[model samples]
Target: MDSSGAGAGAASPNPKCCVSLSAFYNNTIVPCPNCSCNCKGLPGAKCHSEENAGSMLQMPHDPLQEPEDLVRCTDHMCPIRVHWHVKQNYKAYWRVKITVTNLNMVRNYSDWSLVVQHPNLQSVQQIFSFNFQPLKIHGFLNDTGMFWGVRYYNEILMQSGVDGNVQTEMLLSKNTSLFTLHEGWAFPRKISFNGDHCVMPPPDDYPRVPNSSTASKLSLPVLVFISLLPIIIFVGPSHFLDYL
Candidate 1:
């Protein structure tokens, strides 16, 4: 959770592979003087000229896969905890609950915001809160193949918490009809509160009531096994002997 590696003006370790947000948003393409493929348009355009191929920037790598960029803060002294929950998950839609708690004994946060990032999020359908009005919400894609959603709210009182419930819908990328959700789907890979990354404690650290569906699925198998156990014990040996 060393955040020194992440900052607004942080330098890119690999300049050739990384594009600045300013350059990308302005559609400024720095083409290799010797290459033929223009870097001025969409991402991943190839350089047809063999001479310039080596100099052209290769396709941008997935930022999530990079360890140094995906670092999570382990520091717990910040007195705030951000909890993310996937309330409902579907093939193309999902709902999320993000709870921000001020764990400080005597301090209150006048204004705060949560920042979350994903790769395939389409849009945030709704943001609900019981006590506060939504101040601002922004969603945008950058050159790093990551989409970011930032939400702002005002007034979280001392020793209290607030919940931002968001419903979002997603769509597949072009030429792809399906994607797997087993790997961190509909979950924020990175979370920050008021510009500081918060500790993401493990799920086991929190107590949760069992879901009804899960309980029913488990109970049905146990009930069937219990009902058949006596029959198996009383009838198995006799039936085997008769068959023999």
Candidate 2:
């Protein structure tokens, strides 16, 4: 074990460098604010692109020494990012998909797990691919959940590359009092990976369910009524019904 905690519970020194992104099932996207880590323009910063992953794997690793951060090249420059997507709405439930991406080209994460806090998690119907356990937050139903990859599968989050990600989908029953997809209600209230505090985008920047969608739903009854009127009024007229 590294006395400095290199591979043990390692977290981002600068939270600003680990911004996460989120999207809606419709693919509406949002990004974090402009805050960034000091590594960008400093004299001695190190980074690796997807192409150099082979060489990075060959470098010496010393647990006793402080390890270098060989993060992948990205526009946000985050070493890891968790993407949450609200996938669909059903009559009694909604679906979401979460993806954990590794942007650090130098290291892989072992025995990684995710902790998520959301009100609907208390009523989770099913979770796919990942193993799940509910964690209590207030001595009540565990709205906070611990998720990890299935054994001999994705438990080891790979280094950045074509195979550097793990993903899972969840179905949660709607809470009559709290469930609402509008105003970013679908986004998790809190999220963490490997015990590291993650940076989240501003709530204002979260994806919103457009007002028009609500309006369209409201008008559906009228549309159905209108469509049925001609059939009711003309059912008795065989000549007019023949055109239908």
Candidate 3:
């Protein structure tokens, strides 16, 4: 998807949107603009512990499963690598940089998006949204910080029309709650979240066809038999009548 077309004004490049290691810690944050919204905080971000790190919890997912996990610090379901960066102390507000890469090629990408939930805030900021410009790939694709300074926290959805290739990144900030971030969609099909990655489970006990569609649609044998039927009956009679 070329960004040079009619709707090209949607994306802008920035210095902060490039890949940079965090000055605070071992963390690294990529820059990407965010969309703003005032959605409520997630319920479970208030209480977190190392003991509850690997615990399983129910979470919503997009129709298609993502190849990488959403959270990196835990072993829940989606297993994509997650990095954290802070522009300043958490007193006023903090900025978060998140990176998500596609590792699966089974599904075509259309409505890819991310949602971050914070449970410890009285109010939240708006969420700015952007996506990697589209390109073709034999298998996978990646987007690493194509937009920056997004300023919002509610459901942030990426722009459509992307070519699946390998490695992608998106940046977000917490305008409302304490800590909870998600990346997935609900469009193509129902997906299941296992913590490390989103999984598209096979249909629930859907029945299979009795025969292969390729073999079942053949009519060659019937036509051949009909073509030879008259030849065998006619040629054997008139020509051999004198001999019989």
Candidate 4:
């Protein structure tokens, strides 16, 4: 084997428009950037309109057909997208929903996989409509997970159309002492599709759990205590203790 290596060409960076993360939290949905991909400029690029997308999806996919990028027409112009949503919060648990959409009209994936990272992924108690395995990267405190569809069900992600998406929801037990919803802490830190890293929205754009909401929670209890103070004083300590 020759020790001298061939000349390496200039590095070609990853495209910013191939895929994006569309996140929804609380009452806000963070959308992908407009016109992120120059699909129109690409030679032989094709896009299906919203009205035709549903009809095209009804057709059976051809397994032996040649691969091509057939994306649906959207503001982002990407061939695929990933969505993360914070569905609900409970006293001891929180819920999340992840949806993966294939905008390509001609591409269907088999044995697809997703890689996710977040602080509380190890605390996930249950997952619906998907399979999950923890990735033990940091000793016993695994913060990463690999997810895939249930076989014979959503294992094959259909091409772009009305039902060209797969979805799953999960519940994670919260450690009250360490859990927080603020600063996008409730959302996934990173996600990848089929080994390709997805483009994430900037931190400043993430849906925030504002301080006003937390203050509102505290206000109610303080109001109740204030209202009862006069009664306690009027009844005296002895009467108040007996009433309790």
Alpha-carbon RMSD to native, per candidate: 19.4, 5.3, 23.0, 8.2
lDDT of 3 by residue, 116-167 (tens): 2222212324323433222222234221112222324211223111321222
Where does candidate 3 stray beyond 4 Å? 1-23, 27-84, 130-244
Kindly indicate the candidate among 2 and 4 with the higher lDDT: 4
Runs off by more than 4 Å, candidate 1 = 1-78, 130-154, 160-176, 201-244
- Model 2 stretches astray by more than 4 angstroms: 1-13, 16-26, 32-39, 43-45, 52-67, 176-178, 213-244
Candidate models: Cα lDDT each = 0.36, 0.72, 0.28, 0.72
| 1 Cα displacement, candidate 2 (Å) | 9.9
- In candidate 1, what are the lDDT values of residues 1-244, reduced to their tens digit? 1221122233223221110011111233221121111233335432233234333324454555432121111122234444445455555555555555443332344434445554443454445552222222453452112212333433332332233222222322321355433434434445454455433334332323334464476677788776677776888855744533
Worst 10-residue lDDT window for candidate 3 reads: 31-40
Residue pairs in steric clash, candidate 2? none
User: To one decimal, what is the Cα RMSD in angstroms of model 3 from the true structure?
Assistant: 23.0
CA lDDT of 126 in candidate 1?
49
Tens digits of per-residue lDDT for model 2, 1-244: 2132223266656562233445554455765444333245456455666676677668888865655767765556666688888887887888888888887776677777788888788888899989999999769767798998898898887877789899999999886666677776778877777777667778887886666654566677788667767876767555655655
Top candidate (lDDT): 4
TM-score of each: 0.38, 0.75, 0.24, 0.72
**Higher TM-score: candidate 2 or 4?**
2
Clashes of 2: 0
